[model samples]
Target: MDIFSRPQTERSPLIDFDFANRRLRIEGESYPEDAASFFGPMFKSLEGFLADVSDETRSAPISVDLRLSYFNSSSAKALMNLFQMLEETARGGVPVEICWNYEADDETMQEFGEDFGEDMEYARFNLRVLDTDVS
Candidate 1:
């Protein structure tokens, strides 16, 4: 599949999904007025990518990086949905790695990352500390 990218906006995050390379990155704040509208395309793309996974494509691990400064409850739910999808794929034998990046001084974000990481059953989930604040 082709790469899917959306530039960050004041009320949204940057989404860079390089399906060909099996790497996806999301960064910046997320408090879009309509969370579903903002994340729907990404969810569709990810679903499509998962549906197309083959033995050849499964050889490489899918990397997911999330770096968010702040997000509303709706965005949090969307993220949970995203994680569930990736976790399901990993449970199916596909290699999936998720890294939640948070600023070192941001304890709340760190705790949030830890909370998210705890839900992984098959996918490798990691909490990464950012040296500098991205807020």
Candidate 2:
């Protein structure tokens, strides 16, 4: 289970996908020109990681923290796909929690999280407001 850590860029976010800890944290903005290219490997790694989780450790809760300052429509769609996969994985018996962290002053981010949360009926979805001054 290799950790996937990518530094943040002007048009993307910082991705820290830790399979060993069963935790993934994606921070910063996501507005890449090619969303699929940006997220393909992440999605593939997650799928493999989910499949590799042994029965003995399946009980360990999986957590994903999404802390985004901003994202464009393409990135939003990619996010929806990621959320769907997580929700499916959770529905298949693994315990999962997804925290959508948004800046406290960003109503748009809050609404986006809520919209995404609606699709995650099985996974424990949380819309967390972080007290960040970043606009």
Candidate 3:
């Protein structure tokens, strides 16, 4: 499948989903006017990609990197949903690694990362502190 990408806007994050390489990255602020509308396509594409994973493909690892400077409550919900999908995929024998990168001095973001990482049952979750600011 072709790569799915969206450049970051003033109120949204950058989304790059490379299905063929099994790498997904989301960075920047995420507070789009309509959270559902902004994330709907991503959800659809991810669902399609997850559904297409086969026995032969399960050996390849899926890497997800999320570096968000800020996000609203709605965006947080969307992220939780995304994590749930990845967790499910990992539970089904696929190797899924998620790295939540946050600024070293940003306690809120660090806590948020911890909160998100706490629910993972199968996927590997890493909390990385960025040396510099993301914004």
Best by TM-score: 3
lDDT by residue for model 3 over 33-126, one digit each (tens)? 9999999999999999999999999989999999999999999999999999999999999999999999888999999999999999899999
By the lDDT metric, which is better: model 1 or model 2? 1
Give the candidate order by descending TM-score: 3, 1, 2
Model 1 — TM-score against the truth? 0.96
Residue pairs whose backbone atoms clash in candidate 1 = none
Q: CA lDDT of each candidate?
A: 0.94, 0.90, 0.96
lDDT of 1 by residue, 22-44 (tens): 99999999999999999999999
TM-score of each model, in listed order: 0.96, 0.94, 0.96
Minimum summed lDDT over a 10-residue window in model 3 is located at 126-135
Q: For candidate 3, list the clashing residue pairs, or say none.
A: none
* Candidate 2 residue-wise lDDT, 1-135, digit = tens: 579888999999999998888899999999998999999989889889988878898789999999999999988888988888889888988899999998778999999989899888789999998875657
Q: Comparing 1 and 3 by TM-score, which wins?
A: 3
Q: What is the C-alpha RMSD of each candidate to the true structure, in Å?
A: 2.2, 2.2, 2.1
The number of the candidate with the highest lDDT is 3
lDDT value, residue 14 of candidate 2 = 98
Regions of candidate 1 where Cα sits further than 4 Å from its true position: 133-135
Q: How accurate is candidate 3 locally (lDDT)?
A: 0.96
Model 2 — TM-score against the truth? 0.94
